[model samples]
Target chain A: SQQGEEDPQALSIQEGENATMNCSYKTSINNLQWYRQNSGRGLVHLILIRSNEREKHSGRLRVTLDTSKKSSSLLITASRAADTASYFCATPYVISYGKLTFGQGTILTVHP
Target chain B: EPEVTQTPSHQVTQMGQEVILRCVPISNHLYFYWYRQILGQKVEFLVSFYNNEISEKSEIFDDQFSVERPDGSNFTLKIRSTKLEDSAMYFCASRGRLRDSYEQYFGPGTRLTVT
Candidate 1:
């Protein structure tokens, strides 16, 4: 079973609008990371937030982690057409699933 | 700029045949993993290898699945007899030793189509 589940399986917005996606997990984690895939070819790591940290940012991406809620959200500000892709939240496992368990992902489409 | 590399960008095989997916992880990385995603689905973890052995795996990983580090830098996932359901994109990932933070780097996936 996947450890994380993200709400809003799909999203569409204008290029300049902000896109927000949420991820909820069921277990303790070493860290939570977000990745973007363009057409399912490869996954590009975006940002990783440790359990202790509430928030993190890289470029226009902002990620928040609420351990108490076992959930996280990724916000892409001032989005571009290039940001259109599938976004996934991965929970780095600590026990049986030691690699990274991924969520179903949100298919985000950024329009011009 | 180090990255994980996967070979045979795509492969087609018949059912009941064995398939091996190859990967070359970052030179200094100590942990390696294999994952797959069926069409229009999320990537799922298959297995993770560390210390030259299987460290972890998902329920999706059954008797048909096995992982090995054939050499110092090469990691491989072997499917004893692939079923049609096995058709998916397989990805390889690696991260440096635990002391270096264990942030995984992923590779371009190899698309396998079982005919």
Candidate 2:
């Protein structure tokens, strides 16, 4: 079984600063995704990076995957207070029916 | 921008009672799933449904748990007997049928508190 573990469990930054979160997994995966959950709310998809891809960008999010290390990182540039939430890294099973194994998550608080 | 919809933003039940959490996935999507997050804990996958049947399920999905797509557009998760540990936020998610499409859209989630 593969599981993702995120580092620096909690982070606090000022608005407009850069926030980076790291995730490491235990097994191989075809793709890794990042999701954001506001306090007590459902998760919102942030970005996905494939095994072959080193990096991917969507809006202000930058996700980097390093298969050799079985790790990935999510960088949010120009952060805002709205970005205050728990960010989780999830890896889909190799068989792919979209069953995701999620990380413990990084609790990021961007202060305005 | 179609999204998954779940009923009863919050549910309160007593222990040993049966509870059914409902979700209406995106109309065009073919895969549906249920996940739960305990307060202050990580989100955990419970089960995945596709083509009118469960494709995969986690060990947490035990004999007390059951899922059904009784209609073409609705997916439901039933707990035969709820326990205090079942208290958590239950989320419903769905994605398209493409082999390479892996992005899952999640609903607002239902907060279940078993007393």
- Candidate 2 local lDDT, residue A81: 96
lDDT for residue A94 in candidate 2, whole number 0-100: 93
True contacts kept of 1: 0.73
Candidate 1 chain B worst ten-residue window by lDDT? B95-104
| CA displacement after TM-score superposition, residue B58 of candidate 1 (Å) | 2.2
TM-score of 1: 0.94
lDDT of 2 by residue, B1-115 (tens): 7889999899999999999999999999999999999999889999999889899999999999999999798899999999999999999999997878999999999999999
Error of 1 at B59 (Å): 2.7
- Model 1, residue pairs in steric clash: none
Fnat values, one per model, are 0.73, 0.93
How well does candidate 1 reproduce the true complex, by DockQ? 0.68
How displaced is residue A62 in candidate 1, in Å? 0.6
DockQ for each numbered candidate: 0.68, 0.89
Model 2 sits at an interface RMSD, in angstroms, of: 0.8
Interface RMSD for candidate number 1? Answer: 1.8
